[model samples]
Target chain A: MLFDYVYAVDMAHTAEHGARKAGTRKRADAERNIAAIITAAADSLARDPDASMTDIAKAAGLGRVTLYAHFPSREDLLRSVLAQTIAESTGIIEAVSPDEGQAAEAFARMIRSCWPLLSRFGSLHAAAQRALPAGEVRRRHDQPMAYVERIIARGRAEGAFRTDLPVEWLVTTVYTLLHAAADEAAAGRLATDAAGEILEKTLLAALKPE
Target chain B: MLFDYVYAVDMAHTAEHGARKAGTRKRADAERNIAAIITAAADSLARDPDASMTDIAKAAGLGRVTLYAHFPSREDLLRSVLAQTIAESTGIIEAVSPDEGQAAEAFARMIRSCWPLLSRFGSLHAAAQRALPAGEVRRRHDQPMAYVERIIARGRAEGAFRTDLPVEWLVTTVYTLLHAAADEAAAGRLATDAAGEILEKTLLAALKPE
Candidate 1:
């Protein structure tokens, strides 16, 4: 999946480029600090959604005023972090080769690419799904949903999937299971690799000829 | 599936016969009041696991003394609610027959029976999963897990399901997707029926033979 690939790139850059940018006296330093703050805040919020602003500031090694300057309110900060994460995820969804191999294989690859972000930021995803009005998030959600729907449709056209249920139902099911498996992984009930395997099997089953 | 049927029977009895009994006699009324108190406390605790005893008593329409008489501490009350709910769920699990028809049909029926309770008490479940190792909740989780394991085992033995993944992983995926779908349903992102349909497809995909 392109989303998974984007996340990998983002994670690598954040780790390798973070300290180097901090040492330089330039715009890079400021951007690095902002990224650090967002990452720290995301980690704390994952553990406790209601964690205080001061606590997040402390985790990011910034003063409350500095944190507020970068992002005005708790919601604003959270929204920014989520937007960045979603952008990275969207990039991955766009990058996948929809024409590559069988529909099920391509779909599984997309899920694998996106699993890390979904697993790490699952609570935030849940919050976004709940907090955002349908207008904003719907478009974001539709992008991925469309991708999955296309895959299911292609599978059916190729005679690989049973055409008994609506493609929308299949898309919704795939996303729900992904989000659910990610949540379970976050909660320590299932390992990430195990979740990936489950996703693969699930996609295969959903696509198998009846 | 058997377990879910049993749970429905038990829940129907609790709702119908139990309610009627409480209405008939003073002693039964008192017991019912106590049960109601516990249920209210459980609800509050689900929303806020750290809610105080006084807060629970206030919510339950009981005095602190009476609440303590029924459940001496927060742990006791939480444990009792957990046990009762799991026992009820176990009844439902025991009532299902995964062999009732084709595997997919049986799985769909099972998911329908199981989704509502999971959706309603999901937060409490998340709390219980987190509160393990400090109490008897761990022991209680075993019953449902065992029931699910048996279903998966039976499915695999009958050549109705893929044998690559552990049965436990399949069981956990079923619970996870149901919980996730419930979360979506609760948040109004998806209607209840829609969520149920999505869950059914997801489970069928995950469990059906490849």
Candidate 2:
């Protein structure tokens, strides 16, 4: 219902902003198909990084021909997933708006808010990390990492976080723990709520000054 | 050279005691073959969790017949990897002997000793986790977990660590961070030494009393 309402609004806005662009049904349909395929592939990859082209196609409820039409190869499909991951990660960081409030509280808030997405996207991220070199993955993840680094630097400057470590190390450790929380959840060793709570508490305690 | 010396000594001892068990060249050759295959498979799996049987065979410089002779299927191969992982993890934890020092120091020693092995064998462990159910992985990992948990409990008892959280949560968080450290190393985001130092410092800080 919410999507319908929002999508309806989007359609009206797009129609007004550029009717020629919005009026192209064939182009719009292709765009929708690509989005659906990418979303399905992301879900499949998150479940199993080695998910096959056939599996992805099946998951998307698209024919093999259609999937192949959009993505000529598995690498192409993975590229789309990488793009989605980068965009989603940046969007999540932006939405959390880590610049607000006390740096410590802000950091905790980011962890709490980011846990679900981190865990949900865990496999996709891991898959991307595996497929790409660290340098490439880092480059793609630069914006989000920088956003996190800024918040952590602020926390360190405010004397909330320890001053002994570099901001990169601190941010990396936070991400590592976040990924760990996601692994715990995915492994069913910890429920999402429990994982988030433990992570938030541990990270807050660890990152805070002695 | 070590294996040859050990094998010679074992043969002499067995001849003096009972030769039947140690007398066969075929059996000894089979044992060596199996060991080599497992070691190679571990390496290949660590490099690529979905490493194919043929790829493992090539890595070990063995034939399909020999590889299949040892592990009938991918599941069987993965089961061996899981066993190897369990044994190695247990050995690392036992070697650390978390009972030997102040609980915090013991934890650090454990981290320092385990980091190299953990990062090296990370993909194999991840593959095992994916192959086995969580309960099975936990069961296999229980001994090591218990060892870490014992140290954390001692720390809490001695009032060196926080007491508000359950020991299980503390121990889980520690392993989570360790795995994260391993991930960082594997991803090349942090060098092994740096990852270890950051992880040790951060973990000790987090688990210690406020």
Candidate 3:
């Protein structure tokens, strides 16, 4: 069932790209086919952790040799797909206006804005988490950590949060809850809105004046 | 290296079982081998999520079919090992005698006793969490959750904890922190002892009189 859903989404994405390319008449249909192949390969890989290169090519409606021509190896394809997903999600983060109101409110808004992107790219995130070296994951995570840290510091200065706990600890606590909430939602144990609410309440509790 | 270690341990366990089958002549040898197998399997699985069954059988000096006769699937083997590990850790919880001490002291003692277990089993727990059916996992988890609920209720009754939050919420919060701390320690981001200390402080902060 999961595989079928993912495959359908991949097909839809490919169709959309084909439509755009046909409208532009700039690139050949071959470019559109290659895009579809990459999308299918990524979709298959996401569904099956142990999917082989041949299996991915089959899913992409291409021969194994052709798939290799486009992507030299499984790792190469995986890395390329991951890079594209990361770039797309990064664009979402950049598109959000982070200066809406008080620091806490603005931070929450930013988180809300990013939630859909996170949900859509969850499989990519999981793959990146498992495949990347530990230091690389930490390095990539630093930006979000720094953003939350700054928000907490601002909140403390504004008297919106208690000054007792160190900002780093608060940031860690919030991120931990956020990660937990995301996991629960992804596992379908909790509704996304419920998970978000839990996060909000937990963060508020942690920040409350003592 | 991992495969060899597991094979050696399995061989020891098989020898131990053979001794047990004999007229008590090699009972001690059999016991030692059993212990070795369990230790090896636990250590290897902790390091490699995809440790092979053949390697485990070789480690124990048993045939692959024999190992399957003992454990039907990877999930079954993992669950059996985890259950034993959990039972050993629960001994500490039993020793705490939560009813005999002040609320704060009892809570601290409980944390100290369970901290190591949480740390050691963190990754296994995370994996089992992803594999098991939610209903089955929750059933296995009910006992500990009930125990924690009782402790929180007792604390509230004694005026050591605030009454505003639901006991379920408190239980969830404690469990989340315990798992989070375990993850941090496993990831090498924090010392093992820090899990206990952080749990102590976080619980104290959360439970204080309103």
- The lDDT leader among the candidates is 2
The residue-level lDDT of candidate 2 at A174 comes to 71
RMSD to native for every prediction?
15.9, 11.0, 13.4
Write the residue-wise lDDT of candidate 2 on B17-128 in tens digits. 6656555766898889989888998898776766789999999999999999988987788887778877887798788778987888888898888888888875676555
TM-score of 1: 0.61
> Per-candidate DockQ versus the true complex?
0.20, 0.22, 0.11
Worst 10 residues of 3 chain B by lDDT: B129-138
Which candidate, 2 or 3, would have the higher TM-score against the true structure? 2
Candidates, ranked, lDDT: 2, 1, 3
lDDT of 3 by residue, B100-130 (tens): 6677678778888898777876555545544
On residues B42-73, what C-alpha lDDT tens digit does candidate 1 reach at each position?
Answer: 68755654457898889988889988987887
Error of 3 at A166 (Å): 5.7
lDDT of candidate 2? 0.77
lDDT score at residue B65, model 3, on the 0-100 scale: 73
- iRMSD, all candidates: 6.7, 4.5, 4.9
Per-residue lDDT over A1-210 for candidate 2, one digit per residue giving the tens place of the 0 to 100 score: 999999999999887869766668768888998999999998987877667889999999989999999899887888888888778767877787789888888877777777777778756755555555334555676777787788888988888888876566677767666765665566566677677777878877777775
